[model samples]
Target: MINLNEVLKTLNDDKQQEFINYLDKKNKRKDAKNIQLVKLLLIDKYSSQEISEKIYGKQNKVALHALRKRLFQSLIDFTANTCIKEENSLDVKLIKYIIAARSFLQKEQIEVGYQILDKAKIIATEYQLFSILNEIYHTKIQYVHQYKTLNLEETICNFKENQQQLIQEDNLNIAYANIRKSLNEYQQKKTIIDIKKLIENTLKTQNISDLSLLSFKSLYQLLQITTISSSQKFDYYNLTSFATETYKIVENHTSKNKQLYYHIEILYLISNIFFRNKKFHQSLKYLQLMNFYMNENKQKYLKDFSSKHDLLLALNYNYIEKQEEAIQLLENSINKKSSNVIQNLDIYLTLIVCYFQHKNLTKAQNLLSKLYHTDKWYLEKAGLVWTIKKNLIDILLQIDSGHINLVESRLKSFKRNYFKHLKDIHQENVIAYLKLVEIYYKNPEKASSKEFYNRVETSFNFIDNKKEDIFMMSFFAWLKAKMTKQDVYLVTLELINS
Candidate 1:
């Protein structure tokens, strides 16, 4: 997870500086070292020793300790004030309204108290914040006691409605939580058989129905289930149906939805589905739509949304044969900092592949150097696909440069690593592809043989038309092109487009 200071900075640099300045003003202090400490924290490079040296010219751990405590409290106070002023976030405004209502009620300002409560109630209902609505209803009952002029019957009825809403909301929240937990488990070695059963049980147990009404959270959960099922079962039609219905739900309720982040996330999920189905044009279209949402609310989402948008859009560009555009997009985005280590690795590996495919060997080599120097902890955590892809790109670069000895050495290391880390048919298919590359390197004269093509197809017949490994589709196409003596680029394009 991203640190709090970094998340705040990503929200707004100017705002963060203003917050620091506000702290200085409140303290009536000038040139505060703690202010600089706050700045360091925002960049995620804060060190007590560095701060102590900068402040006192020697190690003073005691002073640094006091400063850290003060700075943390100052940040909390600043965030509280800032959130109250941010009208764009309904939750923030709802908090402010609730606070104001309580203060007004204590002061015997009955009209103002009721007015504030009314506003908060509207916001809570609009956002489907049933928990908050329950709080509002309980507060209303107290107000009714103080101002007897209010109708008790109406207040009691509203309270009952809120109680019913709370029950429904609780049920939905629990169902969604369970589904997310199962998805996390599915990311491990667990198969889709158990996951599919879990989904069915959740829907029946929760009384979730396609024909009935649903909340935004429930609808999003449904889409997630459909996405996983579609990928595991290769059922694109069900994915399309669910995704389309989810899109319509978002559109229909856009006005009242406070969780607009879901809209962007759903677009990403839909775009990925299309990409996996090899519908590049449709995938690009949805990505464009996702970009429009990100741009429209850039300040609130730019830092979070930009990285994912660049990655998927670049991938679509790569598949469409717009290599320069793909390379440019990935290169620009890869140099920036991100909180997600796994995502960062994905972007770097994708960029390396794009550079290799674009024939920019020098650029690819530069990225490879960075990967080699990266922390081994990250490399280990990046999982099997990353390790295999990185080594393959290295081998491909060697093949392109005609370094046969280097290629042979790397191939030996690659096979060793693959067998040690991966135990699946996918691993075997990838190693087979690498071996095929080695064969071509050793015997270029056999490339155009029809017999060679037949043998190559038979060698990896188990992996043919297997949608589980979309990452290898282009490589398979390149191998096929080699055997048929066709343009590698054209064959790759045809494979993805097919």
Candidate 2:
């Protein structure tokens, strides 16, 4: 029952209704209880005993458990079938052709089977479905004697080529997994891992060259790895060139319709990297392209990517001095119920930043208060870094609001909880920033003093503005604003421009 409830939570209201209708149609007996079970689960208001009494007019644990298992299986079948119908139409066609071909061949219908296999081969080859193509080639070789028109040597050569492609795909998958594992370890563990070096070594060890023939999905995964590495270092200049070059490669190698999801993902990655590098125009250009591609295929992935798309668009708008538009975008998104908890948290955090930048301290405080979940819950959902970011932002908000006692307590709690983790991640600058915030809270007059300004300047190792992380700069901008007595947003723009 618990497992079923969890799965049902993933469905939207419409999908839940669709699932209920599917259950209604699947029920063959008038006395079927699966539909009743689903309704009870959806309401989420009944105990097992209550549900059993409601459904069976008595507390029947064994019967209730059996009904729950049946409902779970039914849900799985419905979801799997729906996914196949929506996402894998082409693959399904190819599979049906292959199965039909095999059936005909087994029945000694040689000519019809060869014709069907030829059709399957063309579709498979065009989409670079190497595994399916391998099956097609194997089937051909098994009946090669029956079809003398098929040259045995040519069939063997094609089979071997498909095998090579399969090997490359396998190697890419392994390398991608290793890179993700390394990234996870670096994020979670108290250790230093050079992610960029690890990614480079993994690709090199796998013999994956820049011009290696790869499917659209493989290329997207490669870009994902690069994005992770660049994010760790707050460097996107190099990623800009790499992502564009990879985009060009994807265009040359894969069809847009067949790999639209990956194509859209790659576009978003490029735009985000450009945005990070402060190339607002370039980022918008890629975002436009992403939007255009997303609208194709009947907007198949629009819902899936809308939150991220809107988030990036809002960020770009915010940086380009379109604060009202940015705030509006985030405001519209933040109140909507979304299953994407992480993205929703990001929207909340970004909106809070916007509010803070506008000096709307009360609004920021109210929004921050709405994130009522425990830090541990957020840590599990959004990761430790994000949790720390929220804490730091909350502290800054309290400081700006002149809640001195609250700010002091928060600062102390932050240092106690995160000072060592920041140091472990080599983010001493964050620790420095927090200490300066404490100083500003304790002595507002000293914020503009030359001695304190020198302390601020010496505390952080400033890099090229183009390569600096934007969020880090935003925090730094607040400190600089205090020192220079300028608007923090304007200071932020000046810092980025510098």
Candidate 3:
């Protein structure tokens, strides 16, 4: 008979080694059925997902959540089930072991802890406490101590030294800098071919195409630079073309790399450009693409992120006048998150405004009450943008535009105050409102009393709206209706010729 073992071992040594390593890692996982009380007691001690995974073997997030919930729900049951606590009895021996272990760990004395464990193991295999202590000493303590001393000042000093050490030969950072400057200059005057060429050549030389794993750190820095530079100089066509070209290349050749954030940045750029170009569908398309990758990334990685994408999604939908859709998206974003108050506050404020716009003042007031308790939410509520939003909501739902007398009485401040903070992006819609003021000053008859019947005509040419003329006509009619007692519907203007 043939030896089965020999027959099965015919694979090459390289493949065999790889398989062995994989099995070793797989074997280290905790049993799915394994329920340990001690592990739960020490749960708070095991910080970070990666360390928890390493210590527990294979763990699902659901299990961790369930474990915590069970502990809180029934503390006595939690104390009873753990074998480590039962034998050790939380007695002086166990307490002494824990204290010594904690001390050894704090002092980075891993060898001392390991030696203690070995001696304890000789006394009895029942010393499971030693195993936990040893894991803590080796992984947590050793890992933490490898960085530096425990003081903040010393840590800062160490950080600066490390930073200086890394500053050498960062040619990628230099190239990223040049690429951004070129992009900005190109937008301002519509040409930066030579700089673009340099960027293209750098990519070629670095072989940053096809199978080469891209650098996420570099990508984030480059994206940030692009955003800052773009703000300094706005370029519509050239920026869009450049972004589109880059997207095609990256999407086809090297999308598998750590690219979720970069993809989001690219989509944002495209959507903003499309918005400026009066292409609502196109803008929504790019924004949806951004949502797609963001969701994908959230599924794949345990990123250190707060759930703030809801705010962005809501804002985009609101810009396109999809109020209900925006509110739903915000609700979904905040439903399950455990913390990140600042981000949640942002979501809440935006959601409240959306609801207010739809004439749901009761719901908006409820959110405002919740915000009163949340400190960060207060700043956002008292900010300049919130004031404009409040008035817009009042007009959209409660106030009439046709009664010019009524509108003048109600919106007297808005009509007369002349808001001056037009330099901020947060004032985008507000700036459009300011433009209406200027347009009305030159042509007062164009400013209608009925907001619904009165359409937003040629007040601002920059807003992205596919139904531009109709909206302008209807809004002006609506404004006129709100202003004057009679209907004042106007004719729609055709699209501006390119």
Global lDDT of each candidate:
0.71, 0.86, 0.47
TM-scores of all predicted structures: 0.77, 0.94, 0.39
lDDT of 1 by residue, 1-498 (tens): 224465555445567779777877887657577777776776676565776787778999888787777777777887777766653467766877888898999999988898899989987877777778888888888878788777889878988977766666577667667765655443342432345677778678766665225556656666776676655443454466567667776777743235656667878888887776667788888898888777664456666778888899998888877888988888788777566767788898888777766667788788877876432454456643456667777787777767788988888887765554344423456666777787887887776777677768777745334243456676776677767777666777777656
Q: Taking the tens digit of each residue's C-alpha lDDT, what string does model 3 give over 413-469?
A: 554532433333233444565445444544456545444224454434444433333
Worst 10 residues of 3 by lDDT: 489-498
Residue 131 Cα positional deviation in candidate 2, in Å, after optimal superposition: 1.7
Q: In terms of TM-score, how similar is model 1 to the real structure?
A: 0.77
Which structure among the candidates has the greatest TM-score? 2
**Which runs in model 2 stand beyond 4 Å of their true positions?**
44-58
Candidate closest to the true structure, highest lDDT: 2
Better of 2 and 3 by TM-score: 2
- Model 2, 1-498: lDDT tens digits are 357776887887888999999999999999999988888888988888999999999989999998888888888899989889988888889989999999999999999999999999988988888889999999999998888898899899989989988888888888889877766665654456787898888778877785538887888888998898877766777787888888788778756567888889989998999898889999999999999888988999887888889999999999999988999999988766567888999999999999999888899999999999987677667767688889999998988888888987888888888788778778899899989988888999999999998898899988877778877888888899989999988998888778
Per-candidate RMSD vs. true structure?
A: 4.7, 2.0, 19.7
Q: Give lDDT: candidate 1, residue 68.
A: 74
- TM-score between candidate 2 and the true structure: 0.94
